[model samples]
Target: MGLSDGFARPLPTLVFAVAAALSMAGLELAVKQIALGTAYAVWVGIGAALTVGWAMATGVEPASPLKLLFIAGIVGCAAGLKLLPSGGSAAED
Candidate 1:
């Protein structure tokens, strides 16, 4: 969304670039402490849930009970992933 909105706007483009860079950096740091698959799933799940939530909040998308339920499910799954063992010791980080 940010990237699409940025197509002819300077500020939005810059913001999108910075946000993408930061997201990647955070993902890189996360993989150091967790399994790659778990980290990636949590990262993508949170990002998707938040994006949809924001759209609903700002009225860019219509809000519905089903949407909210799915968002909760996504959040729950991400949290569950975090709770699972990573098959590595914390000291490995």
Candidate 2:
């Protein structure tokens, strides 16, 4: 599907995207402030729980071990991003 299919009007799409980003960023900061270690783990666990909930809500079958592993990879990357020193940046992987 194309972007046009998703948005009959641009304003609603932009508004929704901003709202979603703000909410998720708040969650991330809350998790970070609660102690990054425990917070990060809780964030990963919460992410997995949310993915499972999303699949069920959308009537998708529970994925297999390989798929779960791939999902874990993504969560791991997010965790890795948090682990980098506050001012640290990277070039290419």
Candidate 3:
């Protein structure tokens, strides 16, 4: 989103660059404590949901009940991933 907007304005381009760098740094730190797959999925899911929510809130995108529901689902799933026990065996005796 910022990337697309950045094409029209210069400030957004700088903001996008900074945001991207911060996001990557956070992800790198997250992987140190969380499983790579879980960390990545949660990261992407929350990011996407927030992006869409922001677009809708800002009137850049049309808001719909279905879209809101999906966004809630993404957030819920990310929360679930966070709740799961870390480094647990798939099978137990």
Query: Can you write out model 3's per-residue Cα lDDT over 9-40, one digit (the tens) per residue?
Result: 77777777777898899889878878999999
Residue-wise C-alpha lDDT for candidate 1, range 33-87, written one tens digit per residue: 8889999998999889988987899888999999899999999999898887777
Clashes of each: 0, 0, 0
Alpha carbon lDDT of each predicted model: 0.85, 0.63, 0.85
Clashing pairs in 2: none
What pairs collide in candidate 3?
none
Give stretches of model 3 more than 4 Å off.
1-8, 89-93
Stretches of candidate 1 exceeding 4 Å from the true structure: 2-6, 88-93
> What value does the lDDT take at residue 71 in candidate 3?
97
Sum up the clashes in candidate 2.
0
Per-prediction TM-score to the true structure, in the order listed: 0.81, 0.41, 0.81
Over 4 Å off in model 2, which ranges?
A: 1-22, 25-49, 56-59, 90-93
